[model samples]
Target: MEKRVKERREGLPELPNAEKGKVILRFAPNPNGPLSFGHGRGVVINSQYAETYDGKLILRFDDTDTSRKPPLPLAYEQIPEEIEWLAGFKPHLTIMASDRIEVYYEHAVKMLKMGAGYICTCSADEFKQFRVAKSNCPCRDNSSEKNMQGWEKMLDGTYSPGDAVVRVKTDMANKNPALRDWPAFRMQDTITNPHPRKEIGSKYRVWPLLDFQSAVEDHLQGVTHIIRGKDLMDSTRKQVLLYEHFNWEYPETIYWGRVKVHEFGGFSTSEMRKDIEAGIWSGWDDPCLPTMATLRRRGIDPIAFRDFWIELGLTQKDIAVPLSSLFAHNTKKIDATAPRLSFVRNPDAISVGIDADERMSSISVKSHPKEDIGMRKISFDWNERGTDIYIENEDSTANADIGMRLKDWCDIGPIAEGFSQMTSLEPATELAKIHWVAKGGASPATLMRPEGKQLHTIEGLLENHDFPIGTIVQLERVGYARIEKDGNLIYTHD
Candidate 1:
């Protein structure tokens, strides 16, 4: 197996060095659960672009809203490990978004002082109906001093979940709901919180929204480029506005389409997590699912995945590639290096009679017809009753017409002819394709199915010697096979 670096990169944009040098790329996956194939697509593209531009790849865990964190104590540790595994050790650093709560609070205060944000006491029902009726919050006209007092109460836990929320003072009449004085922070109730931090207590009621936290984090960390799904494209614009308000540079964005709704069967992450907890799948890595761990277990070659997704390039059109395409690409990759072995899966051997006197002879077969050198050794012997030789049923059935040599020994054509000459120790002309192993055969062979099963077979002699394990060779007329031990064969697709 040879390790090769990528010769060309796809989905890379043409930007001047001036533009690229300022780039600091990040793959900020909210590790609420194990990442799926869609995440894999994003990861390779993000890392590839970073590699191409000689920029940094930061692995950020946007683990805010601690209430939704996985209940397992080790979930935090597993998140980074999974990210690193899928990204292939390319991230320059790993940072947790939750660790910067103080930073977000500071920015929240700054926005308040600048009169860019205010507090509201709208209940859930009131807020929903307000939006439907195209009306504004009554607190929308509250003075900054009063709003500040509300925020202070929010921080002191005076406000219950949804008792108060702080929203940016954006236009209420904006057609886009996202821009309608969107809530920057809101108190979360227990029903919405799956695994709230117990030790942290309820000292504070306000929690930053996803987009707001992400916007501030990107600017604070000097992230100059943000690649994400188009679903977040609108957020990018809002983030740009936030940066403007803070007098900071906005990161260039490359937004691709989100995974199709049908692809997910309309199952959200929350649903998937519930399914996982209920044992619907094996801890998010079950091979049945498209999670990265499952993909790897199913024999998918990550490099091929990277190449395929990158070549599709980046586009805003939502599409779902069949799982077959990925499996096919991986099969091609494995075929290039995975050695072939021989094994009779169903265990049907051609039982042909061989004579007594010639029992001690040898057969010579090419180790690998594709490669030109080594040979496998095989010998033949009569049973105590002086009769049969066993060979793979498939080889006999497929090549019955052709009398292929059993290595250096006589060619055995078909089973009928081979059995017809039972008395002679020589193989029948029609049974020339018959493969044989000596009475005391030698060679280690592993039989494998797509599911990684091993098969055992008699050893063959090449140049009067037994073949050793890992002896990749052709069985004269048989398909490619690898000699596992001195006498066993493992079947592979080659």
Candidate 2:
């Protein structure tokens, strides 16, 4: 692992000496959907930083928009669940933004009285058009009384959804487009919650912007240091402004760039969720995804993930590291720990002229080839009256010329019938390296498919080879496999 990388990354600016006691950090995920791998990175990074400084980590759900696609707060549960599952730790506190709507409005009223915020009677489309064309709204200079009346109308459900919104009223000509008078609260039915707010029938016509509410909420929660993706680094000014408006101390911020697109295309956590919901992939933990759970399911060690993540360190410049590095690093780490087992995917059985009923000829195979490990005993002979022995079509063909080592036995050349035949195995072992037997008395072996199904098979060699459970050994020219249990094993190309 890169110790220097972690040290350097953590060497960021700390809270000022005077503000040391107020060290609070928070991770606000709007549990609108299942937690994604990218979010996993954020959770770990933020929580680790909080722990480093002995600060409290608050797991807050920014579930302000109750009108989300998934109306239920999947995040409230999934966020904490995924964080615990991946980080092996939980936050000091859990809060939902919906629960704090009163607090936000109370603060919003303060801003309104300060003349820093105003309610506009602009519709959603009008606001969009105004924003696009840089047109100033007539409500921009409306009297405080008029704005308060508009807010009252919003509270009573007298105004329509798009009839009014509360804007921060920042400069439209600000150099940063994001700082250009962004909306603090808006009337919308993004998600309709039946829960009463300030009054009955008071569906929040004015919803607080995530960044704005987050700033105040984080301050209230006493977050001292905030870590976020670089994509959001640009919002620092506005957030800082909000903090100033609330007369609250702003938290120190650390920004890390987004994870690179290792493949030819970019697939973010958000994009992956969309695809999964659209039935493009299996689920959030789909092995093809870069999610933490998916990595775990794919047998990728957590330590390897941490090492890889820190190796990149905290940088403002986004990077596109090659995918090969991740795979290779995982392979090297698992080589020493993961147990070895054999699996032939597409089976091809052949008759061998070996001795029948020969129990005296014991085959002893080492559990792990690289280490001096215990061995397993095997008794191989003709299959009752048949000479059939199964082997992977891919391995059989690849080693056809350079006969493969038959576990603790002799190396034999494959017959032309194996891969050379018209309907036989291909020239390479790619066709079938993972083959298994039906369950009988043997331990249950599992074949974890790409779609997330686990097919339990039997534990035993296709030929005379024998290897004990939890043994890290090679399949004699085949790839690597981890003996999950006595009956099942997980195979990887590495």
Candidate 3:
């Protein structure tokens, strides 16, 4: 296993400040939706660094906010599967913020007693005015003793949703407006957005914001480094202040700019949820979406996804990467193992007539021409007449009585509408080379290819349907495809 990881991680740039003791990292994701290719980067980088230092990796589900970004039950399990698929390793630990509610409460009380936090009952509009004016609110001046009473009121059900919150006492005049006494905890409207975890989601009304929860978890979980997107730099800054207020040292942090995959649209968990709920998408694994499930279903090698990010490394500037390059990388890894088959899309047929011959019953053809991928045999069941075969319209000759070869099968007369076959196994050198599949030897196959923002279905037929479904194969003259268990296909790439 160690050697496997090392082999997959070769040629990566050295991490900065590599000597941190017992390097511990955590990939804390909110379980609102299945992870996308963008999430793959964080999983691979953190896992690689942890392995590099012989440390541990944690999969922490930051599921505190059950109101706005409510958790999806499937996301809880789907995320880890995606991570393991991309990184080829499992996390050593799994944790949920909702499970650690009591711990956060204890920390919140401590902050309240320390005078670093206070309970504010201001309405949303009032807080916006205070933020715009860069001024303090009436709650900001409350003593710790008075704040303690308000805190009790919050816990005793005296405060309704949006009626009160606990805010950390940051500088009111800080240059960044977000830093000015941000709310630490708020009351969730459990009626509108019920918690996903029926056992505990609705049990608590007051919850810590992501900033406070993440900061506390980092310290308590023994995290040594934080790797995240540059867009979250503000989050990093906010967490730093929490670390300071608690008189604790902050963890090492690294931020990289956003990565744009040219083939996919941007990601949004809420948007995905809305689409799924509205039946706009089949599911997270729908070919039109770039979610990990869809990518896996397309027969893409996980190693290809891992290498793409590792080679890109941690850069400050955002990158616009073409998805074709990733397909190119995956092809190299699977070309030798991916078996080949014959597929005729929009098939055109012709009946070749010939005399009885033992050689006409079967023919052997290499699955892959240049590689030692073995071979497949195509057979004809009859001899009185010639073999009936089908070919993709695009690969068919427009003229009849013209000389043509039936791919690895046999020599044929001109490609026409009726049955006509050659008496010999040899074809003229000038015969047109066209892909053909013997009738009844191939099964109906449908290929779903992803377009800009929708899925396009193309009907076709595969010569060897006996191969187990879910097998990844290259259609001799066509692109690669992953056969569905039912014999359909999801096109990977050309």
Candidate 4:
């Protein structure tokens, strides 16, 4: 079953109306923070389709909302860097909505002149009553000239925040009340809540809502296809209405259901930002978090992410998966090259007696069991009587009467006061295979594992080697880890 799954090609379903070299897709993230694991699905699917069709992928920052979900300053650069890291190439085109405020404004004026939109001065409660009654607010019947004057008031700060808003004209009696004259643009007090961008700070009091901004940009950029979540189908409906007002064609859109990674369920970028500010987490790259930066720092290959998502394919059915499912893909990508080493946690010393003439002083084992990656030698502190080795304290307390084998080294008969070395290299019968390091031949190291919002550090002794920082190595009987600059290890997976 596993082999069949692996044999399947890693690609997404063919996009509808997609043409080779002409299919243009986009990934427009709000840039509230760095990309999360949920965001990765969109990135990978769009990137894979773009590559498959030999088309262009545009990275657009949909950062028009400055009051509710404000954009972070560092995200402008961090998001692009992450996209490059994951896709192995930069996006063909990059755009920021905040910088295109003028374009959105121009479209607003055009919509007003054509009587497709009107400025409403109704309060939130009054608008809700009107929408509930399937009726139009008093401002909805104003003439185009009157609406234009209201729009000018909005731009010139004549209307305070929430005093007036531009609403796109849609059917008031429409069954879905949300579609009835949805908000197109609103006023934001730039002094109390300024945009993060220096060039955009307090420059314009009127800001376009997401539905309006994204619709205009999609049409302007000639986006051929749009892939978004099913929750935003209403936004698509709203945008389609606006598209009709301009007599422009709406792009082919595909919607996917929410994917709930069991480990990162219910984690939002806003909550993460607050936690990070409170110092509950280190930063975006904190291993405990599920941000792309954290995944990269933990040594997950970009290919693994790509393959994982492509295998899931495009679906509207909501799916749930464990993090280990992703680790399985990474293990396949890295196992062949990750060198094997020994690590003993909570080590306890045990002496094994060997005859001077029959025992070897050291043993050299293949760095990888099935690969020609070279050999690593384990030196023993052999005296005239015996050699001392360190094993995990848990192993020392285990049943040792049957005997055990020091992996890749030698077999031991039994444990009385100490262990008695057996003559045979291989055990005659089944025995516990233990991973050990020669005393004085290992360095003290710490393995940090992220477990349920907490980072647990296990102090251990790792076999001495000059493995470069960022090298992923499998510790014998232990899981894989990436070597850190300080000679510690960050646990990757089992």
Candidate 5:
């Protein structure tokens, strides 16, 4: 299996210009909500490279867009926790961009004084026209001193939101208009849209965009490598230009094509947040959501989750995969230790009459088929006629005529009343093997199965076992599930 995975991944390539114990990698995420499956790729890939080189991994929160993509207060704590869970270690340094507004302001002032940045009072429409015409905006020719004056106005109340923006001086004739003079800093109305952080709430209105903030942060942190999605290549192009202005060496960048998990393709942090506000989901850890918390709640081993992405490696070709791929990895990691139990959904009761000589009072079954995990004894209550047991409704009458083996117990066949015990302990080869729980040993259970956006519940009876809460167990014919509570089980996967 290891060999197959290596061949499939083609092995992760060594980082360029990387030195042992010198490489520094970072995973920057917008802290709007808990990290989802899409975000895990960055965390895993960057952390893996950091580990391979014995380097430092930094967790940076790009939470400066207080108005457009406001940072959720809870996400401040959730992102680091999720990263630690996925990476198997806490980052060497955790920095929040919101905490360093003054640093960004200092850089902005330096850029303006160096004649590489200008404050533009042009409306968005006016700038778009200039960009489309491949011509410079009027503000491009402003003197550094004049731009600094406008910058002060932006920091104060003189320039309202959208009335002024600081633009990075780039070529207006650049083939890609988006690569033209892009907005680096803008004024925001903190009064109406205050930042979630109490200390930083409405502190200042002038804010730096992602490109400016991230570029400066990466340089300051001495990041040696950056692993980001291919969609952000334009960000790299823009940042490279900014680096040229500062005469800074840009980090080696690696890009992976978008990985669209078939099950979670429709999920977005913003949309999920809106739904969560409307009470559409239970919370970030809801069973149906594709969040790290949800996966942890469903009993997905963190090692398996990490291995799943590591095996995928890095590629530029966009790939779509099903959730089953991850489930397969998880099964291998947990199956050997997951206890086997009987859970009959939509249970149907049946009485099995037994001959006096064939009476079996109790049956002991191994909790694990191939391991010495101990045994569970299921006792039967016998009457003058027969003993009662419960089996899945679908399996009750399917092979009555041919008879069926009550797993770990004797064989039984249809009779006038219900079923009659067979004399032979070993059933015929063609006989169906069905799981059953003696009436006395059955406990009510509810199995929650997540199918896309909907969570379905299956009422059933689980064999009375001593497995503690959070235990991952495999139901005979059903799939693997986690014991959420006394009578609750959340289905993980088949």
Candidate 6:
């Protein structure tokens, strides 16, 4: 436990620009899918910075791209729950882009009237040709009045999905072609792919693009800083164009590089959703996906996630860590609390004929070895002759010379091939001490381990186990496990 936590002895990076009780940071994630480790790292740093400065943290859901990544209604609620679970409190504010479409629309109109934007009706193919030539679209020189008419047509259902779009005016000859006449808003046929909000229910067809919507909301919400990935440097630049157009100050920004968590290569929530729909995955909380929901379901403590990101600190270098890096942190938290239990997978019987009932009752072990955690009483029921001790298959031996001991129980010699025999009770001296269930009301169990996004089940029996569901236990020789709400035992990790 000490080793997992003590490596980070230095202090975290200071937010020099943040003022006490005045700094405001926002974690703006698109609500189109579940949050990933990449998304969590951004939000955790933003929230931590907010706490470090005694300021406010806002959870703003950027749900603008309904045409491509439609806003998942469940995510709007789950995202906040996850954030609160991680930060240990509710954010100072929660804003959804869907709820603030009017504000975005107002700003887009303001830019149009300021002659900083125009409506371009160029076909995608034609726009590509113009972009390649570094030439302006035909409508680039149109008056604000004509652009206003096109915008009205886009909103009032007069335009089809691809008929018209609002473009923020930028250099046509810009080296980065993406900055040339970037589209600020576009027409989407909501009837075909509707927004999930039932109240809105396809009422609006003109939607602001993500870059445009976030810039407007940031200024309105008094955001002091932006924490995001270096891949989004282009996004920051795009938002800056609108920020400058409105004479709004761009917030101080800290950009991090992409992180690669091993065992999750090519993981995508959108693709995972389609796979889930096609029955390729179990579901979002499948214990294999890197989503927060899966992490929580697998009994991953939220504090581990917090510490994991905090330890990563404010480095811009891309980090590639194994799943064990996270499990190590989680194990430190649970090692003291998880009770010790014995599970015999594919039971191999070793019949030890003991002397008396007193010897049979000598086996005892605590819930946790050194901690003050409660203990589980272990008692062995007697057959007509003696006690029937059941141990693991690999631990059984046919030789009577080599001594073996039951864990914290009694020392016993292995019986011969055709004879059930007994040895004198002595202090255990063998190097191999095996765990066993005395066949005294041991409960039938199945340990489910997640092996590369698939479930690997071990049919087994747990010894001296009488805990209710949801009780986490360390299966003596096996890894830690959580008794799920469904009464199934699922392995957390070593």
lDDT of 3 by residue, 327-377 (tens): 888898888878888888888876778766434557778878778877888
Candidate 5 at 477: error in angstroms? 1.1
lDDT of each: 0.61, 0.61, 0.82, 0.89, 0.90, 0.80
Highest TM-score: give the candidate number: 5
lDDT of 6 by residue, 1-494 (tens): 36565564554687767789989999988887778666778778888888889989998988777767888888888888888877788989998888888888988888899999999999888988999999988899999899899889888988888898898898889899878888888877788887888876687889988788888888999998888888878888888887889899999888887788887888886887778779877877776777887777777788888888888877789889898988998998888888898899877666667666445564556788899887777776666656776777676753345756777766766555522445555555643677878676477788888877678889887875667876778898998988877667888898
Alpha-carbon shift of residue 187 in model 6 (angstroms)? 1.4
TM-scores for the candidates: 0.73, 0.77, 0.93, 0.95, 0.96, 0.94
Candidate 4's C-alpha runs over 4 A off are: 1-10, 358-361, 417-423
Against the true structure, candidate 5 reaches a TM-score of 0.96
TM-score: model 3 vs. ground truth = 0.93
lDDT value, residue 411 of candidate 5: 80
Write one digit per residue (lDDT tens) for candidate 4, span 67-123.
Answer: 778999999999999998888889999999999999999999999999999999998
Kindly give the stretch of ten consecutive residues in candidate 1 with the minimal lDDT sum.
Answer: 447-456
Supply candidate 1's per-residue lDDT for 185: 83
Q: Look at candidate 6 and give me any clashing residue pairs.
A: none
lDDT of 5 by residue, 1-494 (tens): 35453444344788889999999999999999989888889999999999999999999999888877899999989888888888989999999998999999999999999999999999999999999999989999999989989999999879899999999998999998779999899888899999999999999899999999999999999999999999999999999999999999999999999898898868889988889999999999999999998999999998898889987888898999899999999999999989999999888888887777667778789988998878889988988767888888788768666678888887877633465666467766667889989999989989999999989998999999888999999999888999996558999999
Instruction: Give the TM-score (vs. native) of candidate 6.
Output: 0.94
Candidate 6: 10-residue stretch with minimal lDDT = 417-426
Q: Flag clash pairs in model 3.
A: 351-419, 352-420, 353-420, 353-421, 401-414, 402-414
TM-score of 1: 0.73
